[model samples]
Target: MSIAAVRIIGIDPGSRHTGYGVIESERGRARMIAAGRISTASGTVPQRLLQIQRELAALLHEFTPAEAAIEEVFVNRNVQTALVLGQARGVALCALAQSGLDVAEYAPTQVKLALTGSGRAEKLQVQHMVKVLLNLQGAMAVDASDALAIALTHAQVRGMKARTDALAGGKRWGRA
Candidate 1:
């Protein structure tokens, strides 16, 4: 059976810079569509949140992705910094929901593991894997590469689930 391509957008939310990447995935292959960061460096907390929302909304409209994925906010040493990051993540979630797309969240370790063999992979290792998996060249921002890694994680996960379901004779297995 031929598997249809799925367009997915992945987001790595931050207070000052929110990274986003779009990709088209079919079977085990994935192709990059677009990737960039939304900067909100010169604004207050609320203003930065609003900027993230508006820019994310525009990107959603432009990409028209079938699904979305976001990296979960990791615990930070500074509570205040974690709170701000959470706010940015909330804005990103709202934008994805408003676009009427199913949003999936993956932990940072999970994303790294999906891209690299080890969950403890370094940032540079993950970035290198992202470029290798997508056959991409040229300079890419670290944030942008991280976003693409998140997208690729979703693609890999969904593809595995599909195959598992197929093997199970189209029956729902494990957790609902």
Candidate 2:
């Protein structure tokens, strides 16, 4: 018998509405556990960041995930929005660090490509693929789906890395 693998929590950080998702993988399979967004009422930027940090900490404790995958903020057409997203991501990192969980980052293009087989696929297409792959039925908010997609992408990359390392006879991280 083998020990069970742990789950991962994925976060899509936004100052106004930070999205989060939990996923588990074992024997080369990935599944979504939960996904949601946390939004703070109108407040100052620092206050909003603090609220996001507190919420992230609570979520980490509740989920008890082994690791975290966070979507990296890319240069966007909207500078202000990007800045706010950066702040939210910082808060998320802080929470993960406090909990002593490892954090990984992925880009949007990478996430889209991993989930939909095409980086340029439309948002609806990505969402549909997520629902189909996860076997989730009926309506799901786009933000929730996006968060799940991010988690899945990280899972795929991590799986590929494991295979490559095995072929090259490399040791797995954090495994003795």
Candidate 3:
């Protein structure tokens, strides 16, 4: 028996550039549909947020993904940068919600670990793994690759959950 493919959209939110990737996954196999970045470099904060929203909305409508995933904000020493990132994330969440997508949030470490088996893996390592996993040749934007990683992580997690649920006769221990 063959499992149905689940289409997913992943977002890597940033103030200047928000990356998005779309994929269809069935069982443990994933095929890339599209990947790109929404650039808002020459706009004010509000304008940038608006741009992100509009572009994401368009992408969602175009792909009609059944699920969505986004990278959670990782705060570092720079407070202002984190705040801006949060804003971008908020916009992304809103867009996903409006599109009626079930959004899943994953941390940077989770994404890296899912793709490279090491939470502390470097960006290049993650990118290389993304290319390998999707069987793609040639270069891609770093942000777009990160978004693909996020989608792949969600796909892996969902696959595990589905197997566990099947093994347990579709019983849940607690709230999911």
Candidate 4:
């Protein structure tokens, strides 16, 4: 069976700098399409949220991703920090939902485990595995690499689900 290629968008939402990555997946393989950071350093919180929305909207228009995967917000020791991060994540989710993409949420540890075989893996390890898995060249920004890892994890997990479903239904799995 052959699977049609699917493009997926991954987001790592941050109040100061959000990372995004687009990837194409077919069967069980995934490749990076584009990855970058959305910097909102020069703006207020509201302004930054607007910036994230606008940029994410543009990416949705350009990539037309079939699905989206986002890193679930983690609780920080600082209440202020957690609140700000949640706000950023909310904006990102809103954009994706408005764009009509099916959004999947994954914990940071889940993403790391999917990529590096350990839930407690460090960011550097996740980044390195993402590079190796997608066959990317040169240096990737840490933020972008993390986003790519999220996308990779989604592709892998979704693909597995598709296969499982197909098997349960007594049919061959193709695209998901």
Candidate 5:
């Protein structure tokens, strides 16, 4: 018997550059389908958010992913920056919710730990692991690579849950 593939989308939200990646997972394996950034032009906050919604809507329509994983907003010393980041994350969450995708939020530490076995791993380390895991070539933009890392992390975590659920034979956890 063959298991059907599950499509997952991951987003790294930012007011100026929201990165997205799509992947297909099956039987504990995952492969990248597409990855890119949604670059919003300089404008009012509402205007930028609208652009993000439009772009994300189109991607959701195109892939219709089974689930989505996003990086949770990490507050920094800069209050303004943290607020803006939260807003961007809200917009992203709305977009995914509208599509009815099962969304999972992971902290930066969780993502880093999943990818590099260290919660404090550097960006370059995460990027290199993503490239290797997906068997991709050439350089990848940091934001886009981060999105891919989120997707991969989701797949691994969910895949483990699925197996455990199956072994328990009570009820399956993920989407049916």
Candidate 6:
């Protein structure tokens, strides 16, 4: 028997801590591959940026995801916080581009709505839902589960669209 191979990586970018999860999509099934965080504590600004870049590059190399999805930067009341997040996001994008992985992004509201069916859902609810969907063995931290939820959202939506198209007898991309 032959195997189908497809992989996706999802990232939640932050200056102090970036969260990521890897999932493989094969024969229309999405499976969790790995997850981790990249963080910098008490360092010079440039040094921290360099560290983030290095960590992201390492993650890309290891996962070798065919596609990458990142949570878009949101506007914060604190300008400095927003800038820091944007900086991290920039590095994440650069890493994916350098790795030649296709990148897509979803806003915070979009991710929340997609995962929990409501933008105002509590963090715990999203985390709990993600745990159930992936059949994770143990409870996951908020940031990590959030990253996984984002990936699961993409998988769920993509699968739904594919099924809908099939029922409607329309062709979609990626079908051989």
Cα error, residue 135 of model 6, in Å, equals 0.8
Summing lDDT over every window of 10 consecutive residues in candidate 1, give the lowest-scoring window.
167-176
Candidate 5 lDDT, tens digit per residue, 1-176?
Answer: 24568999999999999999999999878899999999986999999999999999999999889999999999899999989888988999999999998899999999999999999999999999999999999988898999999999999998878777877674776636
Which residue ranges in model 6 land beyond 4 Å of their true spot? 1-5, 26-29, 164-176
Residue 102's lDDT within candidate 2 is 84
- Give each model a TM-score: 0.97, 0.89, 0.97, 0.95, 0.94, 0.86
Per residue, candidate 4 scores C-alpha lDDT tens digits across 1-106 of 4567899999999988899999999989898899999999987899999999999899989989999999999997999999999999999999999999889999
What pairs collide in candidate 5?
none
Count of backbone clashes, every candidate in sequence: 0, 0, 0, 0, 0, 0
lDDT of 6: 0.79
Best-fitting candidate, scored by TM-score: 1
lDDT of 6 at 80: 92
lDDT of 3 by residue, 1-176 (tens): 24579999999999998999999999899999999899998978999999999999999999999999999999999999999999999999999999888899999999999999999999999999999999999989999999999999999998888877677777754546
Predictions in order: lDDT:
0.94, 0.83, 0.94, 0.92, 0.92, 0.79
- Alpha carbon lDDT at 68, candidate 4: 99
Against the true structure, candidate 4 has what lDDT? 0.92
Candidate 1 error regions (>4 Å): none
Name the TM-score of candidate 2: 0.89
The positional error of residue 39 in candidate 1, measured at the CA in angstroms, is: 0.6
- Indicate whether candidate 4 or candidate 5 has the larger TM-score: 4
